[model samples]
Target: MRLFGYARVSTSQQSLDIQLKALKNAGVKPSRIFSDQASGRNADREGLNLLRLKVEHGDLILVKKLDRLGRDTADMVQLIKEFDQMGVAVKFLDDCISTEGTMGEMVVTILSAVAQAERRRILERTNEGRLEAKAKGVQFGRKRSVDRNKVFALKSQGLGATAIAKQLGIGRSTVYHVLNNP
Candidate 1:
C-alpha cells in the first residue's frame, strides 16, 4: 500500500515546512507529499483534491492532524466516508488512530459534532454583530459616493460620464451621480 501525505496551511504567507517535515519523519516519501496553502474552509483545495483523486484502494492517506483535512467536522466525516467507500484508509498521525476502527468512528462522530456546533456559534455571533451595527445607525454596505472638485473639473472640460468614469477608475453610475448631484 502506498502512503500519501497531505499538508495544508490556511494562507500563502505561512510555510508548509513543519507539516512536510512531520509527514516525512513519519515515513511518508517526499514524492508522496501533497501540500496546499489554502483555507481549511475551502472544499476544492488543489492539493487536497489531487490527493483524493490519486488515492486508490488499499492506499493510506496520512494527515498531521484532523483539522488539516478540514475545518468543519461534518465535512471531514463526509470526506472520510468517501475514502472509506473507496477502500482507502485514513490515519491522523497526531490523533494516533486509523479511521477504520470502532474507537476511531466514535472519535470522528464526536469531532464532527463539535465542528458543526462551532460553525453554528460563529454564524450566530456574526449575525448578532451585524444586527448591533444596524441598531446603531451604522451603514452595512459599500460607502456612498460624493460629488467632489475633481468631478466638477472633469465636467467643465466637457468630459462625458463614460470618459470621466474611465479616467477616474470608477463606475459610470458614480460619474452620472456626481454630475447630476453637483
Candidate 2:
C-alpha cells in the first residue's frame, strides 16, 4: 500500500516547511506529499483534488492535523467517510490518530464537532466586523478607477468599445458600463 501525505497553509505568506519536515520524519516520502498555499475553506484547490483522486483502497492518507484536511467539519467528516468507504486509512500526525479503528472514528467525530464550532465562531466575528464597518459609514469594495478623464477622452475619440477597453486596460463590459452610467 502506498502512503500519501498532505500539507496546507491558509495563505501564501505561510510556509509548509514544518509540516513537510514532520511528514518526512514520519516516513512519508517527499514524492508522496501534496502541498498547497490557500484557504482551507476553498474546496477546489488543485493539490487537494489531486490527493483525493490519487488515493485508492489500501492507501494511507496522512495529514499534519485534522484542520489541514478541511475547514468545515462537515466537509472533513464527509471526506473521512469517503476514504473509509473506499478502504483507505487516514492518519492525523499531531493527533496520533488513525481512522482505521473504532476509537479513531470516535476521535474524528469529536474533533469534527469542535472544528465546526470554530468555523461558526469565525464567521460570526467576520459578520460582526462588517456590520460595525457599515454602521461607521465605511465602504467595503474595490477602489474607484483613477483615470476617469482618460476613459471619457477615449470614449469621445469615437473609438470602438474594444479599442477603448484595450487602451484603458479595462474590461469591455466595464467600459460600456462607465459610458452608459456617466
Candidate 3:
C-alpha cells in the first residue's frame, strides 16, 4: 500500500506550504505530495485530477483538511464513497477522521452534512449581498479599457478591429465590441 497527500490553497496569493508541511509531518513522502493553488469550489483542479488518476486500490489518501478535498459535502461524501469502493482510504489530518470504520463513517457523514449546509448558506449570503449592491447601482462588470472616441477615431482612419487594437494596446475583441455597439 502507498500513501499519497493532497494539499490545496484557495488562491495563488495563498500558500500551500503549511498544508505540505502538515502532510510531511504526518509521514507522507515529498514525492507523494500533490498540491493545487485553486478554489475548492472548482472541481477541475489539475492537481486533484492527477491524484484521482494515480490513486489505486489499497492506497491511502491524506489531506491536511477535509475542505482541501472539496467544499461541497455531497461531493466530498461521494468521493469518499468511491475511494472506499476502490479499497482506497481517505483521512483528514485536521479532523483526525478516517473513512475506515463505522464510527468514522458516522462522524464523516454528520460533519459533511453540516459543512455542506454552511457552504450553501455562505453562497446564499454572498449572492444576496451582491444583489443588494447591484440594486444600489453599483457596477459589477469590468470597466471599458479603451475610450469610445479613440476607437471611433481609429475606425475613421480606416483601421479595422485588429489594426485599432494593435495601435491602442487594447484587445481586438474590445475594439470589435465598441465598434459594433455604436
Candidate 4:
C-alpha cells in the first residue's frame, strides 16, 4: 500500500515546515507529500485534489491534524466517508485517530460534530456583533477613495469623466458614479 501525506496552512504566510517534518518522520516520501497554503474553509485546494486523484485502493493518507483536512465538520465527515468507500484509509497524527476501526469512527463522529457546533457559534457571534455595529451607524464597507467634491469641481471645469478620473488618479467608473449620483 502506498503512503501519502497531506499538509495545510491557513495562509501563504504560514510555514509548513513542522507538518512536513512530521510527515517525513512518519515515512512518507517527499514526492508523495501534498500541501496547500490555504484555509481549510476553501475546498478547492489544488494539492488536495491532486492527491485525491492519485490515491488508489489500499493507499493510506496521513494528515497531521483533523483540522488540517477541513474546517467544516460535516464536510470533513463526508470526505472521510468517501475515502472509506474508496477503500482508502486516513490517519490524523496529532489527533491520534484513524479510519480503521469502530472506535475511530465513533471518535471522529463526535469530534467532527463538536467542531461543527463551534464554527456555528463563531458565525452567530460574528453576525450579532456586525448587526450591533450597524445599528450604531458604523459604516462597514470600503471607504470612498475619491473625493466627491473634487470630482464635482472638475466636472464644473468642463472636464469629462475620463479627464477627471485621470487627473485624480481614480477610476473612470468612480467618476461616472460620483457625477451620476450627484
Please report the TM-score between candidate 4 and the true structure: 0.82
Query: 35-64, model 4: which lDDT tens digit per residue?
Result: 999878767799999988999999999999
Candidate 3 regions exceeding 4 Å error are: 38-46, 49-59, 152-173, 179-182
Stronger candidate by lDDT (1 vs 2): 2
What are the clashing pairs of model 4? none
Query: Model 3 over residues 1-182: C-alpha lDDT tens digits?
Result: 89999998888899999999999998999988999988777667899888888899999999988888888766777888888888889899999999897787778878777777888898899999999999999998888667899999989988888999999999999888888898
Which 10-residue window of candidate 1 scores lowest in summed lDDT?
140-149
RMSD of each: 3.8, 3.8, 3.3, 2.5
By summed lDDT, the worst window of 10 consecutive residues in model 2 runs over 143-152
Cα lDDT tens digits, model 2, 52-161, are 89889999988988888878766777888888998998999998889998889889878978877898898999999999999999999998873777778987888988
Task: Give candidate 1's TM-score.
Answer: 0.71
Per-residue CA lDDT of model 1 for 1-182, tens digit only, reads: 99999999888899889889999998899989998988777667888888988999999988887778888776787888898898888888888878887788678767767766776898899999999999999887767655478877988999988898888888888887777776
Instruction: TM-score each candidate.
Output: 0.71, 0.71, 0.76, 0.82
Q: Model 1: residues >4 Å from true position, as ranges?
A: 39-44, 126-147, 156-159, 166-174, 177-182
lDDT of 2 at 126: 99
